[model samples]
Target: MTDTGQAEQAGGLSVVTTATDGIRVLTLAGEIDHHTGDQLRHALEVTGTARPRIVIDMLRVTFMDSSGINILVNAHQTVTEADGWLRLAAPTDSVLRVLQLVGIDDVIQCRPTLREALAL
Candidate 1:
């Protein structure tokens, strides 16, 4: 089994993975901002090397700002360029609104759940 890279931190945030079939489900919790964006990017970079479809579970993300959105855009671009996929799962209403206002919703795929993302 390929070791899936998962990030878990005490205070800042955490990302947990649950894989079934070939899809990788990454669940995020806590804040996503300038302070934690780089760390999140690094974790994704590592996982990206494996070329797995990425479903980012954001149901627990309590806060997210432009920096977080930038990180998501970067990841989406990177994965697409690599012929992989990146999808957002269960974004908070606030995050969803921000994404809509910023027009990122048109570019990145956002779904209600990881399973839904993978099916698409």
Candidate 2:
């Protein structure tokens, strides 16, 4: 239960970042569109960690667009290249449908709950 204090709010998105047992968890709320994609990207960026394990708690996310999808794909690739992984957790029904439609669910693991996503 460590808070990185890296919470950020931009556009209609709010991100609260915390670290649990070395895993970075980003709890996101609001809409994810072109205007807020940069904020999401910043939050996903790994600073000093060689292998970054990230779990995005998306339960509160209200909406998402292509920009969010692209950012997520890029982040997934970046982390995978470093032998790490990114997981999406508890996305709302609408957001989950979007991810599924874009085939993101097949690429990145999406769990039904944050606790499940964080479980190793």
Candidate 3:
């Protein structure tokens, strides 16, 4: 199990969860750069421990560097390996572009909204 700690990191991003219809929805706000990526990773791991399905709400996010994308990919793999699924919701264009660039758009599930992701 990974250490689950929510500490403020770079780009001023903060991660928090809201549950709806058996899905863990993690809302990420601010920029998710290299330093802040760790917080994202921890949030995913923490959520994955309690739920079988994970939804990450990225609408409030303003930017995401490659490191941020990497954390998402790693979290996806972690959830799948745990016999669960991870979905991304409402990613900003900049973050979406990074995910696409890393070919994550093809591997991970993404939805237009958090409600859609929770429904899935």
Q: Return the TM-score for each candidate structure.
A: 0.84, 0.98, 0.84
Show pairs that collide, candidate 1.
none
List model 2 lDDT by residue over 21-115, tens digit each. 99999999999999999999998998778899999999999999999999999999999999999999999999999999989999999999999
How many residue pairs clash (N, CA or C atoms closer than 3 angstroms) in each of the candidate models, in the order given?
0, 0, 0
Instruction: Give per-residue lDDT, candidate 2, residue 115.
Output: 96
**Model 1 regions lying over 4 Å from their true place:** 1-5, 46-51
Reference-based TM-score, model 2: 0.98
Residue-level lDDT tens digits of model 3 in 64-83: 88888778878888888778
Sort every candidate by TM-score, greatest first: 2, 1, 3
Can you tell me which runs of candidate 2 are displaced by over 4 Å? none
Q: Is candidate 1 or candidate 2 better by lDDT?
A: 2
lDDT for each candidate structure:
0.78, 0.96, 0.78
Give the range of the ten consecutive residues with the poorest summed lDDT in model 1: 1-10
Q: Give the best candidate by lDDT.
A: 2
Residue ranges of candidate 3 with Cα displaced over 4 Å: 1-11, 46-51
